[model samples]
Target: MNPGLLLPSALFSLLALLLPLLIHLARRQQQQPLDFAALRWLGSKPKPRSRFRLDDIPLLLVRLLLLALLALWLAKPVLHGAPDRRTYVAVMPGVAATTVAMQALPANARKHWLAVGFPSLDSDPPADAQPIASLLRQLDAELPSEAPLVVLATTQFDGADARLPILSRSVDWRIVAGAPPSTPMVTALAAPRLQIRSDSAHRTQAGYLHAASRAWQTPAEFTASSAAFPNNQQIVLVWFVSDPLPTTLLEWVAHGGTVILDSSHALPQSRHPVSLWQNAAGIDLLQAIAYGKGRLLRFTRPLQPAQMAELLNAEFPQHLHDALQAPGVAPIPADARTYRPQTGANAYPQAPYSLQPWLALVLALVFLSERWLATGRRGEQA
Candidate 1:
């Protein structure tokens, strides 16, 4: 089992341990040698070198310990335990409670329950998520490879998507006929007036873009060139020839207008470096670039008409709409996206053990002791 930290990178805060050390060193005491004639003559022979002796040892230790505890607490350390080799029966999305009511666990196995990333059924209800192949793959990786998994879900879920990710472990699945999970209704606004520009060579791609807009009940006006900026704040989505970024496009992005750069066409070398967003398996699928107050987004996948016809997924329109969503517009709430995480936490649950509360208690105790040592004496005198 691998140990994990909730905020692993935040452990760098431990470097602040030096702050207390520096304060203690700065509180140096300087003693002046008295000009006593008799004492001077007696100590004229080089006095025995004094070894390093520290004053206020308790106070210095308390301060250092306090800082150390705070850093540990902030790190949110967790210890992962090995999975209990259990023969668990998991009910998946759309599985009827009546169907799984009579299932019993074998005596050798620890338990049988729902496969909602939890040990029991009484915990939080699992989200009826899509791309179930991805979820199954993750479960495969997390659980022990040897443990047998019996999954009961619906046939509709099994055939939900063709892009099923391969799982590490073999699963014994029983598919039943049942209704599919309900997709949440996303109330996307009728898009603002959009201007489309494309080269003659990429006309088909531009046509598909226009079609997608119309599918959402918003029609776009096509233009031969995007040289003329719209008086109204309308977005310009472009698929231009690569060698040199056109003057019109650059100006549009610079002046706080959003531009979605279609990656199907090769782009010329750009001087400004942009970091890739939403990278998976070392492949960066999306990149967002900030240009002045505006932004530029580049999708690494092609959105050509041929590709759309052959293998169109829901990604194109969703991606396009997100790039167009600028500041102060009727912003789409992030949770409204159907495929996003339920808790917006890590994909895998963290290990059970946490050091945060324990560390906090230690910090509190050290602080109280330090306060007592520093101010208790002063208060008594007063």
Candidate 2:
């Protein structure tokens, strides 16, 4: 519906009308009388009728009107306020905080949570774990511009110096971190308590050492060692208490492996599980963290089958749903009875096609008519 295109179309339609009129008038002026040598023979022979006869005017008008209507359509005529408007909200669940808060949310909240991870090409990639700005740009490209967006991060904004552009966009974004505020728009939930069970002093002490190794590997170790490993098989885990995890484990994660930790035995001396901890080096170690595009979820308490289901539901709801809803992921049914039922809408939306189909159909009809007319003329000649 561009006005510039419409103007040319209207001009073309007027030209089309004038063309037939001009032909008709020229034919009338060119008409001449001729004497027949054999009157009887001439009468018997098939006479070629006037191509511009008045009877043919109606059919010509039909053809001309069809062309004009089609041109107008090609100009992309559309009705205003047709309610075909589609809006979407990109719901980004924060790394640790959002995971726990989402668990406490009522199941009826019609929102989609995009799981954060690294981007991949071969398969459906997990969401990125970076700041909301990067995620917002990705979602902007993927979702409709008119859609609202809400970003839920696990980290509380202490009015930091790091500015995120996503905050300024004309979208509804709410950040939930630390304790929940009284704001109606945002809800905060208690961080899930994590308890590490250790029967022996050695295991308990080793866990802390492993935690130290992980902390040292960060900031510099993570970035410096990137070139040493394959892009798809980067080793992210510094150490596992039992043994140094094979390079294969790192490769697996780099190649899209999801490392789920049930660190029920990783908690400190306290009997009650601790959700937050600072290592001996004063580096903050939380109950859950994502490193090198892989997710690490440490559960302080031993998970029952039901608890595991709940944890999985909160952490990777889309993956869990896909595994259940689709038989292909595993031979698992999305039956509610099989698992603790956690129901929600699929996070991804389908692409939309508006006028492409109608245009294709109209083109097909025009070609078919031309073919039919050509065939009819050939049959008459035979």
Off by over 4 Å in 1: 1-61, 67-80, 101-104, 107-131, 141-147, 176-204, 207-361, 378-382
True lDDT of residue 336, candidate 1: 14
Best-fitting candidate, measured by TM-score? 1
Q: What does candidate 1's lDDT look like per residue over 1-382, in tens digits?
A: 5667888677688788788777656655354566876666664576676433444676777877887778777778777777666765665555666665555546665333343354454444345434344445556656665577666666543212112234555566666544545433222224655667777766766676687677656788787664576644355555444445564455445444665566754332322324443423555554554442244556566655453332265565554555345332211111111221122223343246776777778888899998987685457548
| TM-scores of the candidates in the order shown | 0.42, 0.35
Candidate number achieving the greatest lDDT relative to the actual structure: 1
Assess candidate 2 and give its lDDT: 0.37
lDDT of model 2, residue 176? 43
RMSD values, in order shown: 15.4, 18.8
Report the C-alpha lDDT of model 2 over 317-348, residue by residue, as the tens digit: 33322221221111111111121212232334
Error of 2 at 236 (Å): 22
Tell me the spans in candidate 2 whose CA falls farther than 4 Å from its real position: 1-14, 20-34, 38-62, 78-89, 93-110, 115-132, 138-148, 156-163, 166-172, 175-357
